[model samples]
Target: MENLQMLMYGFTVALSLENISAAIFGAVLGLIVGALPGIGSLAGVALLLPLTYKFNPTTAIIMLGSLYYANMFGGAFSAILINIPGDGPAVMTTLDGFPMAQKGRPGQALFTSNIASFIGGLIGMFIVIFTGPSLARLGLNFGPVEMAALLLLAMTSIGWLLGENPIKGIVTTAMGMLIATMGMDAVRGVPRYYFGSIYLMGGVPFVPLVIGMVGFSRVIGLMTDRKSAPPITERLHYRDCMLTAHDFKRLLMPSIRAGLIGTFIGILPGAGATTAAFVCYAFEKRFKSEEPLGTGAIEGIAACESGNNAAAAGAFAPLLALGIPGSGTGAVLLGGLMMWGLNPGPLLFTNHPDFAWGLLASLFLANLITLAISWVVIPILVQVLTVPIALMIPVIMTICVVGSYSVTNSMYGVLIMFIAGIIGYIMTELKYPTSTLVLAVVLSPIFETDLRRAFLISGGSPAIFFQKPISCVLMIAFFIFLALPIIKAMWKRMRSSKGGV
Candidate 1:
């Protein structure tokens, strides 16, 4: 009852015309950004962050958060219509989304993604409402050891979970950790890897690095291919494309399962929507053999779409309640909070209930607004694919250069972006998992700072990690994640041996 009242209060703040309009604008912008090739929600937010500096804290959050969440839905249009992922999380959507669109049911594919996104976002939001306070209390009990162990768990889980080649994932993750260590050592007051260069003083700038790796690098790839995306010629009415009662009944369970899976993954630090989407897709593929995946199956769309959006909403919990970012985008958002003169963590709710609640409330409204925006503009979004890849390269590259400089108005940022773009291109050519690298870069500072604090507190005793209950559990999970592959490999060998006998 109390939670309901508080939610209503939040609605009051979120329902204002200015806030609603901001959300609408954000929704449209997010769709265009998501529908664009070589860009993702993270870059979209970073590119637009400078513009939002003028708004009040709540309104700024409403707009930025809306854009972030709405991008999840927007990415599906391209994935379905053109077989290109507009955002990292939408990569899995191509497996089934494009297949569905090619079957002359593009409208259905778009509807599935949007409806699943809405349901997933709603489920994730309620989970946040009920668990945010308790999670905040839990955060208070986590010390440096626990935090270090948590970061380790996230790093290992992502690397192990994503690719068939765990070594490749680990290598990329290690590269990220190394790159993150280049800046000054705050604890020791010495430069660790800067080599006395002023450009390296703050380490690799995150915005430029991410924009280059995910956005600029991909732009180069598309240009190299020199092939135009297939145009969508479907002109079906929205009603024909909308979900029927039977379709809802069919998708209900998958939506719930994916919602839960995504929310749980999102709550874990360093996990993100891309991970969540893939996890759900793989799970459904493995267990629901009755319905084969990657064949334009509605179940496949439901699982991936719901999982990604749910993870986006779920990623917010750790950021809001614990001052910890659950994903790369969450890390960017933490910076936004600081920029707005607001500190994240448990005190945020107590100190500024209105701001926190208002943000939450806006998320609810934003999802609905996204649905409306998607229905209206999906036709235009489909036409975007027909634009020549040759034309987009220069435009996206220019945006990347400008965005890199905007990070700090420094030529160094642009240089870093260019270098990162080259590295990103090479990494892609080598089949390295760049997402793992992104996660590591985002996590390394927290891992180093906390591990150092733990060492200082424990007088260099490594046993301090085992002394804490949460840390011990996390350490055990880390070891388990590491062992799973070996165990599976051994089991496979045994099965082969038995079969040969």
Candidate 2:
């Protein structure tokens, strides 16, 4: 009943014309950014953050949220048409989406992707509306120990999930952690890694590093690929992209299931859309026994699209509940919240019910708006792919440089972006996953500060990590996550030996 009332209040706030308009604009821009390589929703939101400083808190949040979902939609465009993934989550879509496009059904592929995204988004929104308060309360209970363990779990993700080479992921994570230490020590107030440079006093700026790592790195990589292929010139047919009844029947169940899975994963802090999409793809492969998933299966496309979009909505849950960001894009939204002189969390619901609820309510309208726009413009959007690399690279580079500078207007930002670009380029060549490295970069600062704080508060005792039941449980969970794969591998080896004997 309380939830219902909060949602009702939220709807009232979201109904305003200004908020509505922001959602549409954000969704559209996000789509365009997501369609292009090297310009993901993370970069898109980071770039646009400056513009939102002028808007009201509600309007800024609505716009930022819309952009997030729109990016999810746009990611499908590259995955289907160019066999490229603009974001980590979209990688799953390329497995089947590209093949579907090549099979002369590009229109159908677009249709399913949009519809699946819509369905997934709705599911995630439903969860937010109905269970958000409870989730928020749970989030509030998390302490530094639990947070540390959670971050540790997130760090291990690099090793276990990023690529075939676990060592590279571990090395990348360590490098990020080490770099995060450059700022003043949270406990001692002495700068450890700044190396006496005044510019390093405040530490590496996050926006520049991220923009460089995720955006400029791709620009550099694409620079080398420009000579290998001519520009894409395939035109899209908008009228044919509408879903048929048959297509709807085939997509509905998978879309719904994927959305549910994605939303659940999103609610779990640090599990973003990328993980959701990957899990959905694996689920599709495992359960759909007779069907080959990576071979243009419609189910695969549905799973990828639905899971990623739903995860976008799920990412918001933490922001609303605990004032913590669950993804990099969520971090940008956090900045917007700070800019507006409005903070998120449980107190927000009490002091600013309209603001909190309104943001949540805006999502429903945003999803519908995205679906409508995608349906009408998908065919036209195809032309974006044909943009020549020479033209596109410079434009993207301009945006990257500007975005980095705008974060704090520091010249070192541009330098960091360039340095990150070089690092990114080298990492890519070495078969390292940028996602893992970026994740570590984003989380390591918070992890280091909090870990040090927790230790200081506990009089330098490591056992403080286990003093709280929640933290102990989380520590146990971390060990379990670490052991699962090793145990399975050992079990498989033993079974093989027994069979051979």
Candidate 3:
């Protein structure tokens, strides 16, 4: 009841003319930026952050919050229409979304993504409202040891599930880890694999690498196969995009499950929407989908999209209650908070109830606003699938180059994009899963940093992982996942031997 009263007060603040206008503007701008590959929420929020400096803290945060929340909705636009992902979390969306588009149901795919994202974000917002401080406290328990163990399980389990050939998956996963290690050592601050280039000192930039691996590689494919037809040759109207009753049923359960799980994952330190999406998709793979994942299954799309959006919403718990950024974008928001002279911590809600609750209220408003905007815009966005390959190649190439160069304002990022594109194309030909490699690149650094910190805290003793309850549980799960294939293989061999005898 107290929470409800506070929320009503927050509504009063959020619904004011200035705040509502800011929310709408942020939601619209976020959609445009998120639909563009490589320019994700972090960059989008950071770029717009300075403009909010002169505004009141409440109004400033409401706009940025809306932008960040709406970005999750807009990311699926590109991932579903083209093969490219608009942001990191949308990487999982591309696995099923692109395939669904190819299967001549681009409209339905977009509908599923948007609806699932809405459901997920709604669930996350409710959870955050009721359990914000408690959830943040739970996240505090995930120290270095626990985080390392959890990441290990996620990497190994998801990597194994990604590819048909387990050996190839392991090899590619290792390859990504190697590439991630090229920059300065996380603990010692010494360059390990610079190979004589000063640019390697900073390591490979993630935005360029992702754009090259996922987006530019498609451009390369289009250039090589100029005669290939567009994915959607027929005209698609808004009416054609409506989901069937059965499709909604297929989407609902997964969205609900992922929303619940993703919210919790979001509250964990450094386990952002991308990781939540990957973990939720992997979890969904254990269930029976109407169609195989990566082949345009609705379940696959629902799980990852919902998971990412929910994680985006739940990320606010840690930021508001603990002053700890749950993701890179959250870090940017934290900076904005400090800059506005509003300290975010235990006293935030007590000291500035209006600012704290208004931001939360703005998220709910943004979720609805973004959903309405996406529904209106999707019909136009899906028309991109009908464009000729010849025209798309140059346009996509320009996006790749601009997105990459924009990250660092250097040609070095563009160079990395081209190199990664070549490698991604070759890997595609060789049938190696680029997704596995990209996931590894994203998670390995976190794993390495946490592992080193854990070890340092424990005087290099391996038992430190088992000493903590959370780390022990995660480590156990990791070993179980690692050994499951071997156990199954041995069981099969034993059964075959008995039959032969």
Candidate 4:
């Protein structure tokens, strides 16, 4: 009941004209960013981040949140129409969405995905509203030992899930930790990797590095691909571009199931929207649909779209309640919170009710805004995909350079960002997941801080991690997730050897 009252007050703040405008603007911008290929939410948010440093923290968060959710909403447009994923989460949308589009029902695919996205997002918000307080309550008991164990779990999952091989993931994670060790130590006020240079005092600038790695590197990679995606166009009447009453009836249950699935997976640290989408689609595949999946089935689109959108919402749970991010974009948002002088976690709800509740309330409104605009602008959104990638790359590249420069008032920042972009491109070429590196970078400081604190509290006893029940559970989970891959590999090798003998 108290949570309800707080949320009601949050709605008042969110409905204010200024915040509403921010939400609308973010939703529109996010949709545009999501529709652009290779410039996923991570880059989109990073590119726009420097602009928010000047805004009030609440307004800044509102805008960023709007962009994040709206990007998920807009991602389906290109996925359904052009068969290219607009964002990572949209990959599954292509399986069935594009098939539907190819069957001359482009509008139907768009409408189904838009509707599913809306429902999924709503489900995500409710899941947060219900679970956040409980989690926050539990998080209140998390001391250094507990938090350190949990951080380990998060880092392990990020590496294991983001790529095919865990070894590459661990290598990137280690590299990120090494990079993070650069700059002055927060506790000692002394440089670890500055090498007598004053400029390295601040360590690495996150926004600049992320902008280079995600936005700039993506642009550089596309510069070589050279080939354009399929052109998409449609003659539209209002009816053709909208979901029919019958279609809604067919989709309602599937979207709901996916919403739940997405919310569950999304709340787990290091799991992501892409994973949620795939999981839900696979889960739902056991049911009979009007059309077989991967064959233009609306049911498949519903499951994928809803799951991803819901997962986006679910990702916020760990981020808000534990100050732990589940995905690359979640890490970026976590970084934003720190920059704004706001700490995420259980205390945030008490210390910064306005930021927490206002952001939550704004998310609800952002969904409506995204859905309404998406339906009205389906034709316009579809046309965006047809813009030559050749033309878009240079323009996006210029923006990224400018965005990176704005992060630090130095040309040196630009140089570092460009170098990071090269590293990102190389990582891509070698099939080493860049996300693991970003995940490692994001978690390094937190993990170090908490582990040091735990050691201090435990009088230098490493067994402190196993002493607490919660920490023991987390540590066990961490080890299991970490060791399962190696175990499976060994089992496979043994079986192969036995067969050869």
Candidate 5:
């Protein structure tokens, strides 16, 4: 009942005219950005972060939250109409969504995605609304040791889940940590890797690096690919907007289950929409005997769409409850919060009830706007898939450049974007997953800060990691995730030997 009252308050805050406008704007912008290949929500949010400085806390949050959900709506375009995924989370959608599109049912595929996403996002939002205060109460007990362990666990998951090889993932994580250490140490007031250079003193610019690796890199790769492909018009048909009763019945359970899975994963650091989507896909394959996956199964669509959108909503849990960002997009949102001179976490609700409640309220409105717009625009949105890759690459590059430069108005950032684009292209050629590298970059800084704090609090004793039950359990979990691949490989070899004998 208390939770219900709080939700009512949140709704009241979110339903205001200004917040509604913000949601609409954010949704529109997010859709446009999410439609572009390789741009993704992280890049979109990073580009928009600077603008948050100009708005109130509630307004800024409404905008960012809308963008987060809107990206899911827009991401389906490329997945169904084209084989390319608009964002990382949408990659799973492509596996089945593209196949559905190829069968001349693009509208049906997209409709499933939007509806499932809306359902999932709403479920996640409710989970947060009801469970957040309790979670925040628990998070209050987290000390440096717990934070260190949590970060370690998260990094391990990211390292394992984002790529086939954990070694490369770890290496990328280490590189990001090194980059994060370049700025002046907050505790010591001394720079570690600046080399007496003025620009180095401030550390690597996060927005530039994020845009460079995520946005510009895709541009370079696409430009190279454009040399051989003949231009073709993307054709989309909107013959179907409503799902049959059978289709709805078939998808409901999976969407709900996926929403739960996605929300749970979203609350944890290092787990984001892509991981949620994959996990939900695996779960669907295991549980749904009637629906074979990876073949345009409605279950597949429900799982991927719900899981990804739920993950977006779930990503807010840590941010609102504990001030930890669950993913790169979370980081941008967190920065926006701080930019408004508003700090998030347990006290945020107490000190700024309007801001906190208002933001949560706006989520419902945002999801509604997303669903309505996506439903209405499915046909035209599908036409976006027909854009020539050659023509689109230049425009994408321009957006990337502008976004990167907007981060700090530094020419050096543009240079960084170009350079990172080259590095990203090279990594792609080597079959190294960019997701692993980008996630590593996002988490390394937090891991370093917390690790250092943990060591300091424990008088430099390593045993501090295992002193608490939660910390100890998380550390063990991290080790298991790190070891699974190696163990599986050895098991394979042993089985082969036994068979030969």
Candidate 6:
């Protein structure tokens, strides 16, 4: 009841003319920023942080918070309409979203993504409202050992994403891990695999690599196959894009399940929306889907989209309660809070209840605002599928170059993008799973850092992972996943031998 009263007080502050206007502006701008490939929420928030210097801290945070929250909604637009993801978390969205769009239900796919994001954000906000500080404390229990074990478990999901060829999948996964290793060592801060180039010392930039591997590679395909027809030829009306009752039923359960799972993942230190999305989608694979994942299944889209959005909301728990940044964007927001002279630790709620709660309240308003805007624009965004391959090639290629270049304002990012694009194209021709490789790249650095830290904490002893309760449980889960495929193979062989006898 007290929490409810505080929230109601927050609503009053958030509903004020200046605060509400800031939120609306932020929501509109966030969608545009998020829809543009490579300019993710981190960059978006960072770039805009300076502009909020003059506003009252409460209104300023409300605006930036709204932008961060709405970015999750906008990310799905490009992932569904094109094969490109507008942000890291949206990468999983492309697996089902683009395929579904190709199957001629682009509008429905967009609608599904929007609705799932809304549901996930709602659940995450409620959790944050009631259990924010406690959840932040829970996250503190994940030390280096536990984090390493958790990442190991996440890496095991690569096997599931590898498609039909285990060998190729393993190879690609190894390649991704190798690529991830090129940067400076996490613990020692020493550069490895740079091969004498100063640019290589920084390793590969993620935005360029992802844009290259996913977006630019598709551009290469379009350039090669210019004669291919567009995915959709018929006119699509808003009515046609609306979800049916049966579709909603399919979307609801997965969204709810992912919401719960994603919120928990988001609360864990350093496990952000991308990991949440990957984990949720992988978890969804364990269940039966109407259509198989990666082939336009509604369940796949709902799980990932919902997971990412919920994780976005859940990320705020640590930020508000403990001043710990759960993700890169959170780090930027942390900086912003400091710049505004607002301390963001345990005393924040007590010291500045209006600022803290108003930011929380604005998320609810932003969620609704973003959803409404997405619904209005889905019909228009779906038209991208109707554009000719000949025309889309150059356009997408431009986006890839601009997006990659924007990362560091250098040719190095663009160069890396081109090389990764070529490699991605070849990987496609060779039937290697690019998704597995991308996932490996995303997770390996975190895994390596935590694993090394765990070893250091244990004085190079491997037993450190088993010493901690949480780490032990996670390590056990990892080993079980590692053994499952071998066990299944052995069982099949035994059955065959018995039949022969």
**Could you say which candidate leads in TM-score?**
4
Per-candidate TM equals 0.87, 0.86, 0.63, 0.97, 0.88, 0.62
lDDT of 6 by residue, 1-501 (tens): 777788898999999999988998888777776775544666566445545665798898888988988888888877877676767899999999989988988889989999999999999998888877564455466777876786676556444434555556667767878998996997788999999999989887766776677666656765666774535445557776799999999999999999999988887645688889999999999988889999999999999999999999998887787565566577557656765788676667777889888888899998998899778866654454455667656766887777777765899989988998899889877887665566567667766887888888889999988988888988897787677666766888899999999
lDDT of each: 0.81, 0.78, 0.80, 0.87, 0.77, 0.78
Name the TM-score of candidate 5: 0.88
Candidate 2, superposed: residue stretches over 4 Å from native = 186-192, 229-231, 285-295, 322-328, 331-352, 436-445, 480-501
Model 4: colliding residue pairs:
none
lDDT of 1 by residue, 1-501 (tens): 776788889999999998998898888888888887657787677667665666788888889899998899998988988798988899999999889887877888889888889888899998988777678778677888988888788788777765666667778889999998998886787778988898898778877887777667777787766565655565556675777787677677787888889988888776789999999988877656334788888888888999999999988888788777766567667767766788777777778878888888899999899988888877777676666677877887898898888866899988888888889888878887676777787678768999999999999998888888899999999899878867876888899999999
lDDT of 4 at 437: 79
What tens-digit string does per-residue lDDT give for candidate 2 at 1-501?
A: 888778888888898889988999888888888887646777677667666666788888888888888889888887888888877789999898989888888888888999999999999998877656776677567777777776787676535555656556667778777777887877678877788898898888776777787678878888876765445677777766766787788888899899999999887766788889999878877665234788787889999889988888887776677665666677667656755787666567778888888888888888999999977778667877676677878887888888778876877999998898889879978887665665666567667767877888898998988889878877777777577657766788899999999
Candidate 4 accuracy as TM-score: 0.97
Ranked by TM-score, the better of candidates 1 and 6 is 1
Model 3, CA-based lDDT: 0.80
TM-score of 6: 0.62
How do these models rank on lDDT, best leading? 4, 1, 3, 2, 6, 5
Which has the better TM-score: candidate 3, or candidate 4?
4
lDDT: worst 10-residue window of model 5: 228-237
Better of 2 and 5 by lDDT: 2
Evaluation by lDDT, superior candidate among 3 and 5: 3
Q: What tens-digit string does per-residue lDDT give for candidate 3 at 1-501?
A: 788788889999999999999999888878876775555666566556555655798998998998998888878877887777778899999999989988989889988999999999999999999888565455566778877887677666655554455446566768888998998998898998999899998888766776787667757866765665535445567886899999999999999999999998887655689889999999999999999999999999999999999999888886787565566577567756765788676567778889988889889999999889888877665554355667757876887887778765899989998998899888867877666666677667767998999999999999999998888988998788678756765788899999999
On a 0 to 100 scale, what is the lDDT of residue 55 in model 6?
A: 79
Candidate 4 per-residue C-alpha lDDT over 1-501 given as tens digits, one digit per residue, 9 for 90 to 100: 877787898899899888898888888889988987767888888888887877788888898999999999888888887778888999999999989988988889888999999999999999988788778889999998998999889988888888777767777878888888889786677779988877777788888888888878898888875476666555555678777788898788889999999999999998899999999999989999999999999899999999999999998888988988889898888888888888898898889888899998898999899999888777777777778888888898888788888878888789878999999989888888887777778788888889899999889998999988999999999889889878877888899999999
